[model samples]
Target: MELSVEQAAELRELVNSRDVPADIATRGRIVLWSGKGRRRKDIAELLGVSLPTVDRWKARYAERGLAGLEGERPGGAREQMPARVRSRVIALTRMTPPAGTGLSHWSTRELAKYLARTENIVVSWHYIARIWREESLKPHRSGTFKISKDPAFAEKAADVIGLYLAPPGGAVVLSIDEKTQIQALDRTQPVLPVAFAATGKRTADYVRHGTTNLFAALNVTTGEVLGECRPTRNGKDFLTFLKKAVKPHAGKDIHVVLDNLSTHTTWEVKEWLSKNPHVHFHFTPVGSSWLNQIEIWFGILTRQSIRRGTFSSVHVLVKQIRDYINSWNTTAKPFTWTATAGEVLAKARLVATNMKKIVNNNSN
Candidate 1:
């Protein structure tokens, strides 16, 4: 074989360069040796390859320069998964596993096995996983939802949400709720402080000291919390807290947002509302207490103060609760409520539609 100066230089570089593929470099060496008047038998021996491999590369280089040595052999590409198989995998992923399999959801391996057993379609778990990734499917995770059954859900939600979005001028809007039966638990051993690369640790076992109830009233405009720890969360305690919450804005009309708890609608509370005509009550829908902003503050209190605190007695727990409330009031900012009444009603209608479909399917 004869070669141009450029081809000779390129072949030399290919054989010497580390980045080129080993087989391509070997072929470059064969071409170079052939160009230098070397015998086929000697080239095979020097390169540790059979005579047929040597002849094949030499012929390929002769017919197509450089390009012939770069690509795979004919039919070297992987075969794609069949369309029917991919569709089957996606369909099965959207359903529960058959009974007696004891699978609440489908795993990649289990789905592959089930397909092989029942449909006689053999495929690897990797293929199914790839299909899931392409389709954005996750069978191993689940989320929770609740649809309010309150007949007046829309009306009640709108009333409370309206108060949050736009409170009446010169009237104080307060969201009130009671966190009942908050237990004071003392860890059996002292908690270990957090260290480098380790989280703080505490013993799982604890001593039950006692329980207390917290009545909290959150001012909507100001985000300040007026809270009291009481022994019980009965109607009387709620009335006392309400009076205290209302005392500051004396003479101004007060609009209170609260859940539809028995304590809130008791006879005494109704009588108090009648006597104090300036005060108005707006109740959140049943099972939809999340509408009240005070519930959001209570969640903050639990996560920040009560969840990990080691209270030896009820008195200690009460003091901690009071301290957190005082600290919160010092730098309070109102929670932003973005959802409008129409948006909430639209979502509720959607959830209700889904529930009705599920119920109809089950009945059939």
Candidate 2:
């Protein structure tokens, strides 16, 4: 419902009026907020009343207008929600959803259905949702974590972390990585630029022209990025990028931190390493790209360039990537790594222990 100017003014007057009963004034405010598109539950919360009270006030106002608030409150009081049932709802939300439901998280509607079936209760999903909101119960999202299974996890992590915490003197430390198969997608419609009132919008459909692979090197100390976009992602391309990245710091000792990608460990890569005796490689543990700072730079690149950009062709995409690299070089700051290897190992070990306990309990 939308309020007419006169109706809104009258409600505002009631809300401000000293003569009106507090209850009547509150109902007036509820109706006013509802007319401005506020929900019943929100009105109830702001007025310190129950959902049923909000509904009654709105219903009465809709039916009898101002005259409705003239009498005693329309449904005197609400029966309390069953405390035990509320506890059951909360407990279920904390637990994993039933396997047969094919749901990893509990939706309000799903919980209401489950509760109704199991406990012989008739309750609205809205009510359940309100309860969950009050309790801050969101079982729908999960946090992510990874524990590398590499045997040299400890040694590798310490090596990389040592580079971050205490880098070798007079050496160029570079965190390098490749973002492969980046598509040049043109939106079917033009992008609407963001404004103060709204975020930018884009068409869901797009035209794919071509793809390129981005090879990037982040200078850990200086915060400079050396990048190239190649048509292929292979040992040969990586080698070419490596040669280019090292040219500026040719005489200085170079230490590169990288993931354990197949290309990074190829015979050709090894031969290149052998040729450049001054250059050293510190590979992060398997499945632990987070240990490399370049991954953080890649995230920034994706968000600022690739994610929202509309590219007509691979050439355009490459140009955008180079441009973004140039812009970043002017303002980039060295990425910080605060957690020590010991702290990281401890957290990972704790996760592993918790996971083991869960598995053991489930098996029994």
Candidate 3:
């Protein structure tokens, strides 16, 4: 068959393009080969399709052009799933399974089986899964939340956040915290180093040599950390670390943001604060230790240094921690806190309100 330039270009594109369906591309090839004076039988053999298949597509192209090559097969589209069935699938998915089923949440297969047995709504697990994906539902996953019960939550949070956003002139702002009971663990067998196409492996079992406590004071302005590995996390040890952290600042005023731990509020610490009038402590609200940015540094320390490290003794663990602290200070950057006090308080209030509504609904 003779072809126009436009038809030739479209056929070439359909044959070459990866996005075009395989069958459509094959059809394009058949039409192109036929236009090139190749025999229909040769085209069929080259494409590994029957001679009648090649003839059918060539007839389709001649009758309707490229439009006939695309779209659904000869028969009409499949029957639409009932709206009621989709609705029931979504509704059951949002709810917990019945008490005696021993299921905490609904899986696609389990949900399909339950619906078939109880509701007489027979459907495949794949069909139910499709509905979940369309609706963006994941019953298998869960998250955690906690609302601070401190009556002075707003005041304390505002105080700490204010320091982060805007610190007083000529005063040093530090976020201080203790990461307690860090274990010095050694794997039973030496870890296998990562190689090509393989991940590093370690024995599931470990020997615990001992534990150590790390007290860290993160300079909020410069991101430099003053950390010490102490044998204990008592008030005396915290006081010693605090003095070490404050030594470099000398005569300047120091503002410390820390959580409300018993060790932090000890009489010795109170006395030290009284004597060093330039040092001020702003405590985060109860159970809201996340407000302290030193916790962020602690997480980094755990992930990068301690979690994967092999330490035979507490001394080795302490040395590794100190080394990491030294390295971190060299390239340290301050963690930017963007959320304003009002924004944080607003979110907390919303969560509290939602919890209250849930509680009231349950009571009713």
The candidate that achieves the highest TM-score relative to the unseen native structure = 2
RMSD of each: 21.4, 14.4, 17.1
Computed on alpha carbons, the lDDT of every model, listed in order, comes to 0.78, 0.75, 0.78
Ranking by lDDT: 3, 1, 2
Error of 1 at 62 (Å): 57
lDDT of 3 by residue, 97-172 (tens): 6656766467777898898899888886646756775687766543112356678999999999999999999899
lDDT-wise, the better of 2 and 3 is: 3
TM-score of 1: 0.58
Q: How many angstroms is residue 143 displaced in model 2 relative to the true structure, after the best TM-score fit?
A: 11
Q: Candidate 1 — which residues are off by over 4 angstroms?
A: 1-145, 190-204
lDDT tens readout by residue for model 1, 252-317: 999999987889988999999999999999998766666888878887887678866889999999
TM-score ranking, best first:
2, 3, 1
